[model samples]
Target: MVTMTVSHKRKDALKDVWDAVSSGWGSVTSGGVWSNAETEQEFEARLQRWENSGLAHEEAKRLGQKPPRAPRGWHKRQYPEIKRGDKAKYGVIGWARAVEVTRGANGWHVHIHAVLVLEGRQQAHERAYALGRSMHVRWNKGIAKRGFTSSKEHGLRVDVSEGAERQLAEYLAKAGEPEKAVRNSVEKAGKALAREATLGQHKIAKRGGRTPFQI
Candidate 1:
């Protein structure tokens, strides 16, 4: 676990870096609930039927390959390619990160945390809703009464504000399993900024100048 005592300066630096890296992107969280089966086996059977269907086999044949291994759940089967396509639609710019997807006898759920560079804040929600609808996943527009909010089917929850980067970053960092690219970008930027400040101080000291950071 990488822990740091966040001073005011450090916080400001992180905010700056996050903003710089994510300026044009709108933060989006989209997901769906597949089913509410009484047992896992019932859900698996449905998935198996879908996989063995002629349509699935035709899709594999169209790609000139065998059917891919079955995903453990809906999120695993669907979200990854959708995420990549979303990013690629913007010429492979911006970030697509996911938190852990979980399943239970009651239902299965996942949240895809994304920074949409191609779509501005003005268009993010519309685009997100369109995409969510196309995927046939339940998009929840408001909070659920209990349990995981993403498990509901209202609409896609999209937000793009001044503080959005930090909010999305924090979500991705939950459970110590952050999206690799965003986590590395934030960490690298912060480190580079600190190192530059330190080097600047060292240069001033070599010239017998007072260190500005000293109070």
Candidate 2:
């Protein structure tokens, strides 16, 4: 059973992961990867699972016991923790951005706009393909028979460059806007852990592709 809670420590852990990804150190690139779902059915199903997991965890906590064991494949929606010991797989940082809306003609529409920073462009593409396949294989049925399709795979849409820093900062800012004190605490904790760059403060070259010190 995994007990997931929103705490200062957890927030800091997330900040550290975000800082590593935003730095783009060692040949990093960024892009949006769309999941391979011909219809939103598969994505919706996963969301239902996520919601149910949250409810179960809350219920268990209320009973003052260890949280119930999460269902298989439940980690897909949680924050991707970058363990210091796993340098190889931890090279990527990512998040899923999804929103649901009701359209007059289409009813409910769910769109997934996941973003990732990878070691390289080639790696970015390869990783996106793998992510799409994993999501399909994990939650969807008959993936072996129908196989995978580009339409259902993540689309390569953006190449994050120097300007990505600003975007990353914006993302972090928005993420913790609800609580300034907690956000500051997380930043401090993250910087202490990373010991490289402070959270949300690194000055990458600006929008013109030149650092402030550049002439």
Candidate 3:
């Protein structure tokens, strides 16, 4: 654990970060439940639970099949390629940084990670807020689409920062894990022979590509 020594000052800073994330997600949808970005008033009402384990156990359970894990911490990162994908011939936008796809009852929830470069730290924050409005800009008549909101009561979060070089490196390294979940599990099982006990069964072939007589 990082110990997360959060002072009131740190809390305020992180709140700004979270607001940026929520607003950006909302803007992508354009508006409504799909772009359900929480406002200042909403946070004022629910900050207690926000400081707590996200929501109560019931809500967290609803988000995950088993007990939900702690919410993933957000960070800003840099990628020379992601920032200049066009020149690299990869066909990606500079503003787009990361994305997360998750399974749920309805379907997969696709979360985007965008890191737009701004002038400075203050400008970075200002742009972060502005991005929130864009979350709903995609809605019909500038209305939001679905598959975004957490529920009626809460909204998702967006985090933005200036010069995310370190953050981007970490996200990229870990990104492979979730993307290859199924493939990884199958590979792991094939490599290990789990032990089982029965009354008579004892010595056996290594299963390490061994012939019966080799034992």
Candidate 4:
């Protein structure tokens, strides 16, 4: 199980990751490509498992249809650590850059939908892919294949491109607001979905697109 409490060293390390992502990187960030999924039904099944096991719906949403699942990526809530890494890395490497680490859950495997952008799409992806591999190696404390998409039947997904950062931020802001104030906002979003919800559109609202539902 993941530790809910942070030790001094852990806190410091987290700060380091935060610093890497937040530095004066750039307007465009490089994207990391990693995906894992089985089927739509399977995805929902994973979401249900998370909810049943106490994970928030926000986390489940991240586990949308995808492939190379995410680490510590359980359900709807988006993990800031993933995006933070991107923000820290590419923020300095390119012109206009941002990272979007989306979530997805399924029996197949849950992974992040990461994206990075820079002056050019081509170079941004190349750099982002290499960096992702390096980070995975660093974080996991081992060396692994580093590239834009996974190889050996794992590269089928892992979306990337511009606006991914903003898009992900907006998504998290709506679904997984942290404090009570923000969480209340996300709850309101739930109510909004109950109201404006369309057929097969019962998924959570767009992060920034919808206002928090009122009581």
Per-model lDDT:
0.36, 0.36, 0.34, 0.33
Predictions ranked by TM-score, top down?
3, 2, 1, 4
Stretches of candidate 4 exceeding 4 Å from the true structure: 1-89, 92-108, 117-122, 139-158, 162-215
Segments in model 3 whose C-alpha atoms lie over 4 Å from true places: 1-93, 139-156, 162-215
lDDT of 2 by residue, 91-184 (tens): 4444433211112221211122334444655554455555444433322222122221122333123323333344446656765455665455
Per-residue lDDT for 94-142 in model 1, tens only? 4434222222222222223333343455455466445444332322222
Query: Candidate 4 residues 108-194, lDDT tens each?
Result: 111222223334454655665555554343333211111112232342222334333544456566655555554444455323222
Give the Å shift of residue 133 in candidate 1.
Answer: 3.0
By lDDT, rank the candidates, best first. 1, 2, 3, 4
Q: List the residue pairs that clash in candidate 1.
A: 139-154, 139-155, 140-154, 140-155, 141-155
After superposition on all CA atoms, what RMSD does each candidate show versus the true structure?
A: 20.9, 22.4, 25.4, 24.6
TM-score of each: 0.22, 0.25, 0.26, 0.21
- lDDT, model 1: 0.36
Model 1 lDDT-worst window of ten: 1-10
Q: Find the number of clashing residue pairs for candidate 2.
A: 2
Per-residue lDDT of 1-215 in model 3, one digit per residue for the tens?
00001111222333333344445444443334332345556655554443354444446578775654443331122211112111122211234334332233322233344444334354545555544443323311211222122321123244443243534445556745664554454444312121111111232323232222332
Candidate 3 versus the native: TM-score? 0.26
